[model samples]
Target: MHELIAAPFLEDFLLLRPGHASGVKIRGHHYLELRSLAAEEGPLPGWLCRAAHRRWGLDLDAHGSTREVVLVREPSPYGHGRASYEVNNGCNWACPHCVYGDKRHEGLPWPQRAKLLHTLRDAGVVWLELGGGECTIDPHFADTYAYAHDLGMMVEILTNGSTLDRPQLLGLFTGRRPYRITLSVYGATETTFDGFTQRRGAYRKFRRGLAAAREAGLPLSLSVVVTEANAHEAPAMRALAERYADRVREYTHMSPTFTGGSDPLAQQAPDYLHHRTPFTGCDAGHTSLNVNPFGLATVCKISRDHPIPLLREGVAGLTRLGGIADQALRRHSGCTDCALQQSCTTCMPLVTLYRKAGAPLDRYCQHA
Candidate 1:
């Protein structure tokens, strides 16, 4: 049965209309090699894989699509780890759709931030995401970049690109791709940008900032958060993406599981959740640690309750959280039925967005 199910799925994926971009077997398994598939394509492969597994218990996509490079470190005690630090959680643009919104703006003082990086470096963190509402808003953005560089950690910043126009931003990546600057382009027009962020005339600043970052010879990754308002504008956005090939990553809105209120926080049913393509086993609880300025730690960024304190501790301590590393959070449910599940980032934070307690593998992930 396994062989029969897998054979057809492979054939179907291979026969996908535009044919395939690249195909080369690394070892024993076969992968339908391709460059990139949109969110719609994510679930198809995973759902078919699960059906094959259920019929005969075979995992077809054991070998994921090959990437241009590898970012994770080996010999990691926890089996996986994602590195990050709190540079500052304030932003220049006020995108109403932001999950963190004003909450992230309230951050730790300069002294605490100074110690935070040293602690992360001591733990052997390689890639540190300088995430926030926006890291570029800090007056010491360049210094922060230098600090991360000095610690021998590759830095990545999540920003709206309003400040990248500053010449100093280039110095960080002059000779090499020192850092990754992700510019979130909510809308191509000033009206849309201003409307979403509640700030007028933001499009101009973002465009200039992106040009500055590109001019600086820095690596740029565009993160587009698609919502109801901008769904129709996808084609234009895609054309915009074509301007910057292989550097853009668009994330469709994963049902609003957090308190990020756009315009007004209309009371929605807690059970009213939305599903995308594949169900991913988000090991953030096991793979990464997200700490706010207050020192409260949770598995993912949307956590609002049952928080663990990791201000003084490190990534290794995330496993020792009160409710983490439990059987409930060991896995999630419904993912096995997903077709694009293989490409999904199926983290619990992505699924359990309504604010739940304990990290049990059974809560959101349950393998069929």
Candidate 2:
């Protein structure tokens, strides 16, 4: 893995560390504007060296010059700088609140997966999030992650933290390091957690994984997921997460599945179902997208109506994405004439799911 990445981020250029979130935004031409700098083999430009030292306290000069630096020469044609990919739909735990109704342990083979990564890089994606039913358990997890990091994309992982404590995984993460590893906290106690996940010994594994990650000093974030099954232990869950992670987020709302299945909605805690803020607009298809394991690209995770077969057309398939996003974000037929349209907080794709599930109006609409 390259120690430093100098890549084009949208309209601006950035100097970023492999595992770190913060970066130095490159302004003015300096070394980056010079096309020859990318091809030349020598010490890194003095300006870049200085920027790295000032920003990350990195000694690029001592690191044996430009060969260690990964320089991106061209800008992205898709105009997208970030994306989230589901490496597989498989999970070790069967959580009731999972938005993906069906969990399948399947993904593209390594060869096709490599092609997808290159396509994402060529499309100018810098921040890539790898998720799944549990990405850590995927067969190609290690290779996919290392390849993405080598391709100059800062990788973030969303996982259940089950297999994180394994020696191989720990070694892999310790070596390459991810920009962030977000673990989903189901419950505080073994009974509550294992019961919630429908997997015995889940809580024990989670605790072990948490300890391993903290010991390794990996960048850690926690999502304290709140559902009816584990709502009673919410406080404990938050406390446990805070003990291990510096960054903790709470997820209270449970949405229907990506396929518009409402099975997961039954797990939503009534008290936690707060009103959503009005939907303004998003840059989902325009500036960001979501991809499934099969290389099907959609506007976002929820709006899966029009999926562009990325493997067939490659990045060119993304041309239809912006238009698809525009259509998917519009108000559904039921919501189109509603008087609360202005203050409605739920996006159209979500609203469509609620409508499909026959969800109570109060759950998503203002009038209810």
Candidate 3:
């Protein structure tokens, strides 16, 4: 006989076989195990154990819960099972380097959005990132965040930190301690920050927002989008973030200019285009799925305009996304045989999107 803890939230991420195991959570830690193990059944499949280790770093044989393993190593419990949804695509700040400007936001209705949350929970999604041009600016932001948390998904918010301290929003973080927020820092000083944002006194508002989040004891993190203007102060910005945030991440690779037109602020560094890494594979539809506010689930945030809707289809549609990715790979036969296959940062869906958009693919083409 094998004993398992009862944790309903982990059912999808853990892949526990029905009738074979049970779930329970104690002190925020989920414990799980097989209901019965016969001598003839042998040990658990090696693939299952390996996947758990790779994605979550949990040792199923150890009998200890993921809570113990993850808390010691990371600040949040967002162990690999992540999916990002753009609650809305409208941003308060017109940052020159923004990536999703071309994709318009239609706004997912509250009823549809609520249903999608339950569908995601059913699909075994544990980590849900609420993002957009800015998640806070969305009218349904509070309701959506509350719904995600209520469904037992570990919620993460990606924002510019300009609205973190609103008194009305304080009630959202009342229950959980592991909730996370990612604040993008433009520069270390008020002058540079305001200049990058192109808004007078924007820096002051940002500082106030960061202070509000810290005071609320939210699990705050900072990210600096490296650009020609702010690259010099990257270190200083990081140090500044360390003062208030629990963690900091850096985005050095600048995004391609959005499809519509040229924005001087959104232009990427020339060097950024040349620095390539091996195109291993993408986790877009397989491990992670990006959903637009219109309730359409595409391969990734960059390819959000694609018509593949996973909201209505639920988790069953993931198989379709996988097939789409496979077809994309087949379309790019040269990628497989290329000498720079190991160093190619471009992926199949991205190549397809660029081709469809009639955009210049040779820019990422190392041969050129």
Candidate 4:
């Protein structure tokens, strides 16, 4: 119920509002000002009251006291400040393009999930993304989401939009307000969408959810996934998404499953397979990391080689993550001898998956 959250974000400090994307970054005297104000027992200073109103459309004075503001004075010892957590690898629809091959409906119960969220907060994660085979379908979706929001982390959800229409879910989101909810659009029409998902009435459900989300005025983003099944409707999908969301993105390339299975690659639309830009570098483990449902931490979602056991080792386990990221990004066996290494756009982990799957060279390699 705190209106304003003051916390350390890496080297900087942030004054964030729950359910809102816009925030005020403060340091030096400004940070000191808010810190002092948060410690006071009276009504908030007029400047802060006015600033909150002007910035986030929040009227701090209406709250009547400084108790509405929460400040985290302790700086996190961990370097990473962002993470993507898979709430569960479970989904309602069975899309062939899903990167997670097996849709197992399993995740930590509320108690364990609460501990993991606390760990993430203590580990300096300010921006948290909750995703999965379909995170909204997770039994603990509402609980996990509300807890993360209360922890003062800006939360983003990656969902398939099937469950968004539920009255309970709409009420939850309306109350807490996610930073953003990104939904994937498989197709524009019911036949293509349901066929692509291999589930009957999927498109109808998706539209219902989309309408509910829109009506709620919750922040929305859309991902138009172009696959062999839906490529013909790509333009329509984009147009439909644009109408519903403020931000719309189109994704054509399909990657292998996290377990190095190429099952998803079969859904790739050939005409949409454009060459990627040259591989430069990434800051996965250094700045961000990925965590599975069971609390296994990896450098990133793509490089899930040797996962660090977060539950066992705690935050200390993340110390070895940067090294793992370095190793995973390095040029591996196939790319080591390639003459076009500099021009090769695919990263090493992806190249490894491509090789493992016996996929067409043209899909990832310059040699083709």
Worst 10 residues of 1 by lDDT: 1-10
TM-scores for the candidates? 0.63, 0.96, 0.73, 0.95
lDDT per residue (tens digit) for residues 1-368 in model 3: 11212223422323321112122223323222221222233345444356555544546665443332221111122222468888988877777877675535458889888988876766656668899888887889888987776555667888888887787675566444335788899999988899888787888989998888778777788997678878778789889988886577777665444353334333455543445566787666666677778777766676544446656676566666655545555535556677766667777656654444454555456676
lDDT of 4 at 27: 62
The residue-level lDDT of candidate 2 at 165 comes to: 89
- lDDT of each residue in 1-368, candidate 4, tens digit only: 77777777777888777778888876656666666766775566676677678888876665666656754445678867899999999889999988898999998988878988888888889889999889988888899999998887888999889989999999998888888999999999999999999999999999999999999999999999999989889999999999998899889998888777889999898999776789888889987999999999998998898899888788888889999999999896767787898888988988888788778888888888
Ranking by TM-score: 2, 4, 3, 1
lDDT by residue for model 1 (1-368), tens? 00120111211222110011221212112323222222123323454455445543546576342231111112223432345555566776665555664545565566666576655554445556777667767766666667655544556777787777876666555632454667776766666666767777688887887787766656677876565555556567666755753577776633342553333222222232245455434455455556665656665565445666556565455556435634324335554365645655455444555223222332234331
Candidate 1 deviation (Cα RMSD): 14.6
Local distance difference test, each candidate: 0.51, 0.86, 0.62, 0.86
- By TM-score, how accurate is candidate 4? 0.95
Model 4 error, position 214 (Å)? 0.7
Candidate 1 TM-score versus the reference: 0.63
RMSD of each: 14.6, 1.4, 9.0, 1.8
User: What ordering of candidates by lDDT runs from best to worst?
Assistant: 2, 4, 3, 1
- Of candidates 3 and 1, the better by lDDT: 3
RMSD of 4: 1.8
